[model samples]
Target chain A: MIDKINKISDVEWELKEGFMPNMSVPARIYISELLAQTLEEGAATQLANVATLPGILKYSLAMPDVHWGYGFPIGGVAGFDADTGIISPGGVGFDINCGVRLITTPVKASSNEMPKIKRLITELFHTVPTGVGTHAEKKLNEKELDDIMNEGAGWMVNNGYGNPHDLIRCEDNGCMKGADTAFVSKKAIARGIPQCGTLGSGNHFLEVQKTAEIMDEEAAAKFGVEKDNLCIMIHCGSRGLGHQVCTDHLKEIEAATKKYGINIPDNQLACAPIKSDEGKAYFGAMAACANYAWANRQMITHMVREVFCKIYGTEYDELKLVYDVCHNVAKFEEYEIDGRRKKVCVHRKGATRSFGPNSPDLPGDLVSVGQPVLIPGSMGTPSYLLKGTAAAMEKTFGSTCHGSGRVFSRTKAKEGMSGQEIKEDLEKRGIFVKATSNKVIAEEAPDAYKSSSEVVRVVHDAGISLKVARFEPLGVIKG
Target chain B: MSFEELDHTADYLFRCRGRSPEELFSESARAMFSIMFENNDANNVGNNGTDNGTDSGSNNCSNNGSNADSDAVRVKKEIEVESDSLSNLLIDFLSELLFVAEVDCLVLSGVKPKITGNSLKAEVFGEPFVPEKHGGGTEIKGISRSGVEIEEISEDDGIYYQAEIIFDV
Candidate 1:
């Protein structure tokens, strides 16, 4: 796979038309030499396979953190023409809008605060519902579920889970337009209802941290982040509901693929024209799931605040959302393709939007500094806070790397180490961890993933986003 | 029927083989269950660390034979699902199994599957996934169509069916 593609620039590699017979356009991957060394042949082949999709704009692009996913690479980003192009569920991963939200607190770090941080993480573990087959304290009826799918963070705020300003800090005001409850399957609804306000197992986590260093003082101030300031990061998405939606829609689109006579290399890459009934229906369901994810994260944020309040008697409002970004999602946006601007459907799986300065998607305070890009590192590592750059807007469809992509398989990671040992190691580093099970701790050990700083540097050096500050975990609550 | 782990850059990959197609599917389900819970069968009573080939950390919490506890090993569960083809039949079967694991906290065991027309009927014997009674490993989020392969291959044991599946762990 590495031999099939050639380096086009210092950070970009090209897979020409001849690389795949059915490819509709050339493919490009943005990675440094070290990343390319570990890039799997199957992953590169998957990226090339995405190029075969009809109406794919520019190049089927993969970010520095790219890895083999279902149909597209995990960090893959692609845009399709709105009128003639197709929409594929494979382009958007199963965890619809599995995203991250960063919140800043007035609390500061100190030697005496270590016990408090440990106590806070322990409290968070019990406060937030987690693990497989887990249910939230609140169960919703059909109407309430619909309200959540429709109103998203707005509903949460109005219902008293969050403040109104939290909406502006979210993408699309925390509710993507065009969500239709009717498009959501009954099974999806059944799965989603009980799983709301949860941080599902497998890599989802809530972390308490402090800014360790500042890379850009002005940019960090604009985002309300500085050294020694306490912060929280929540990583989760539309739990069972989104998984069911993807399963249902993937089957639907597979049938539609045959009906539409669109040939694809993989079954998971099933799709239909954007205007087609199947395509429109999938989009509607996906949007609802995305909204559900935002609401889920918001609820988790509310729970996090409750933990802080119980621990320190601080007001919930004292913790403010810096930004919430959807890593796996598809949105209709206007981008300049070639010389003319066109409206297209952009699909980002395991990737985050890094909209540059002056972009309307940013909040008022962040508009001048570019959108806040939150990148969570692996367990017991330093996560970076970055700002979107104009170069990102010009090159990556306003997208950047999401997280440190995994290097070791879950099974491999678990086989090599004991969860108890991992927890002990993390605690030794002054990072307390509370998890549903030790196996998760072992599976998510820092060594199981690539260096997040390296992945960030690839994108930052490539000029997609620039580092603003660094956050080191003080405590973590893992599901 | 037997299963073994295959190395993937990310997620869990399993290779299962059996004398026939039905056996293959059942073994596949067992492989998936073992990945979730070290004790795929109640009779084994959490035969922990050795089951995963490598140490699965199951000695941490094996089992006690008692019916009164919610953690008591379950007897059995019957499941039935249909799809257009065998590949989808496998996906549907595993998906329903995952649903039970996520929503019901059942650890599947004694999987028996039969193909009828385009659909599949399966019976799963499982126990409540008691953290106090069972060793918990990686939680599988979902099964994927990516890199899924079902083939008939011959070995010294005679003609057997084999499957390669990837899970979103």
Candidate 2:
């Protein structure tokens, strides 16, 4: 049951304390009435549960793309007191630090590039491993795994996987601290060892797109995304390693829940006080997973560049990383609460941080234009690259929606569509697609999700995150 | 019980129907776990004990006893899973059951599961007290409803449940 909701504006709704039992503060949702009504009852109910978490301050928030997830609803945002709040694996999701990275190419959008696009996608599918239990061609030994976990994308840059400039454009510079490899379990290490650079199945993809619209001139200039410019977007994460970490921590946190005398509505919400031993262990393990994901993306970026070099006979420098952002993560960031500046652990399960311009965290070159926000739409639809705004900081805790939220379940998606049929449809529309499995294609079909353009419209109008450019898909390679 | 094989895109579909969802969950668990090992002989490990050496089967049962319900005579669970492929669907369903046993302190028994393809139907009998007739070692968490759903195929109007579950890591 929920109550005390107040309409703050046309697009923003507030959930006051009396709305739920044990709630510590109010909650804010950035969405229009049309989008709100489409939300599943489970999403709102679970969001209420998130607000009850300990050490919560300001609000438990949901982006317009909010959908039901494990514990915290996907697209949900909540910040907890670093010293007193709890850390839950459910908040980070199974694919730790799963995110999107965009790279602009020298190529342009045109029907003439169809054959070349097909060749590039085929090369990518051959180079990148996909599906369940898929192992990479290059396996990591124990010491190498530890190094990759510690150094993150920096390790890749040092090892010739990517350039140093790529890291500068990534969120958190492509690494987070406190990832102690010692906290990771033997099973986790084993599962991750052979899967360092593989793209695991389900929703993960590598797509070639071309900018179709430029909405913000200033931000687009900073991001190097202009109309008709070709770009590559890689969507993946730590793979088996991240899944194992969540599995290992869920058991540990369940025990810690009893030890700490913490009460939660769902066992999936297992957690411990942030400063406690269990919490520290999970955080360390989670960081390692995050690093692994960054390294994986870096390796894939190298592959994408290789494909482009082979197709266009151009140098690697021709393709550059515009920005990479992690959507599923927990970060210790500084935010003002009660007029006091404090460190808070911000958990964004399926949400992205949309820090406004001039924030200290932005790269020096991007400081004047705000952080670049990458919102990948469903397969075959248009994806957006947005810029953060000052309004986002005041309204959505400097956060915005990640992508087109799921409207139909995977089962429903598969039932109504066939992968072959979907592939043919996209092909007819001049989009090339290479997938590891037909089932994955069906489950991620464009119709099974909300329109990304509509979702972006709500956020842009709401002033949470403003649109910079929209890219239409030209080709996609899915795992 | 009735069983049907429906197409689930890349994987074949298996659907089972019982009088109740409890029967569906139990039968589904058994059918799914059977894929992990070569045989369905539950008693083969009875005298052999756990080969993992982490804990004896009896000790595990004892540890689980404290968490059993005191007043309730029994609880029952039903499970289903949908995945893009057969292998992932199997792992997801079994892992989910393992999570429930380890975290929620629920002991599952009388599992009679049936798997047709990607669709798994199982019924599980859960009770607060450890069943004296059977020894315990494995547990199942509730299936994740995140992407779990039933879809109707227009080709034949066949209904299949697609779902996944997380187990104790």
Candidate 3:
């Protein structure tokens, strides 16, 4: 399968338009020669299939961490012409705005901070509900749920869960515009209401980390990273709400695909024209899910802050949100398509938007340094902090890899280690872990995923996103 | 007749087979719930190494057994759904069950699905998730339509249905 594609460069491969029939554009995959060896043929085909979508501009792109997903590859990124292109739930994924955020603290790590770290993680594990069927500490009513969908993280601030500064540090001010609650189904609301502040299971975790290394000293300082300083990272999404939204809209859009005569290569890629009624409704509902995710993360951050305050006897303000980036979800942004700037629907599935410095999309404080790209590794792996580069804008629609892509299946991982055994191994490595079950730990074993440093190296050398700092886990809480 | 886990890199994929579509659907549900509760046994209480407000290390709270305490709390729910095709009906049925599993905190079993034309009706049995009794199960995010397959293969002696499903976790 790899022989069917053309290697454009040391870090890039191209599958031309005719690789799959009806492909309107070519698929470009970014990976180092080393990482390319691990690339699945199915993922490469999925990328080519995405290129078949109508109104796809320039290229259908995949990052170094690309892996086979349902329809689009996990690290897929593509932009569609707003007036003539299409919107697809498969491209955004079921967990809308499933993303990550980094919280920096002035407290530096010490040689013997394990006891304190354990206490903090234990408290967070209890305080923040994890695992299946776990609800928030407080159940929200329909009215509050709507407010969260409409207002995003600001709803948390108004309810005293967060502050104004937290909002600005988030992408798109923690809320996507045009989120209409009317477009969101009641079933979706019911699923979301109880899970407003939860860290749901499967690949979602909260980790206490310390800066292990810093490469871009200036950029690291600007992002509030100090070598050896304690930082908390939270990875999760909109919980059940986002899942329901995707499920509900996919049915509608599937019908719309038939009505509009849109021929899709895969059922999951069923989509509607960007201007159609179904398309508009999906975007509105999807944005609402995205807001819920932002609100969910904000609440989790608040809980992390409370945990720190209790442990260190410090103020809540001591833990500051460095930045938050969405790995899934579609956004309407202007980019130079042909010669002039035009608005296109940019869909990022398991991919991070790596907006370069000086772009107006970034927050004012981040304008000089570029957006913070948090690439979380699997359990016990080293994660890197990277900054978006200008080359990303010129080539890959300002997007980059999300994390170390999985190489082994969960079954294979579990076959090698039990959750208890994995926990003991990490503990021996000086990383404390609190998880809902031993099964998830086994499935998420570090060996199950590709090397984080290798994936980062590919993107860094490809000039999509450059490495800024590296973090090693001190303690992790998973559900 | 039963379900088995299939290899998928990112999510849960399973292949289930039965003599008919109804059995295939039921087996599919069983497959999903089995994978979910793979690590969990009723005896594994207080599994998170933290005080989860539940009693720890008590064998009496096992929800899967004939214990009167757990049997008395068993909840039976009736599910009715319709779709455009059998394949879609399968997705809808499993998805509705998943919703119940998450929203109502039920570990469902005994999925007796009755399919007629592109519609399905079923009665399922489960009990409220008692952290002390059920411990932990994999939280499936949603059921995906990708790579979904439902086919009837004929043998020399009999005909059986086979289905493939992938769950986003």
Top TM-score model? 3
Q: Regarding TM-score, does 2 or 3 come out ahead?
A: 3
**Top candidate (lDDT):** 3
Chain B TM-score (model 2 vs. true structure): 0.36
TM-score of chain A of 2: 0.97
Worst 10 residues of 1 chain A by lDDT: A129-138
DockQ value for model 2: 0.04
Q: Write the per-residue lDDT of candidate 2 for residues A1-479, one digit (tens) a residue.
A: 12335788877788777676887787888777777766776777678888888898788998888887788888899889998899988888877999999999877777598998988888777777654324566778989999999989999899889898999998989888889888888767876777777665566788999999898887788888778988999888887678767866876787898899998877667789999999999999999999999999998898779878988787898898999999989888887777888888989988998999887679999998899999999999999999988887765667899988888665578678787789999999989987755556776899977888888998999988888999999999876
TM-score of chain B of 1: 0.80
DockQ of candidate model 3: 0.39
lDDT per model vs. reference: 0.83, 0.73, 0.86
Instruction: Identify the superior model by lDDT, candidate 1 or candidate 2.
Output: 1
For residues A25-143, write the lDDT of model 1, one tens digit per residue.
88888888888878888788888898889889888889888888888889999989999999999899889999999999887788678889978887787778766546776777889
DockQ (CA atoms), all models: 0.30, 0.04, 0.39
TM-score of chain A of each: 0.98, 0.97, 0.99
Residue A445's lDDT within candidate 1 is 86
Per-residue lDDT tens digits for candidate 3, residues A1-479, read 56777999888989998988999999999987787777898898889999999889999999988998978889999999988999999999999999999998989899999999989888888888887767887789999999999999999988999889888888898989999889999889879988888888889998999999999999998888999999999999998999999999999999999999999989889899999999999999999999999999999999889989989887898788888999998999888767989888999999998989997668787899998899998888888899998888889888999999898799899899778888989999999988877777888999999899999898998999999999999999887
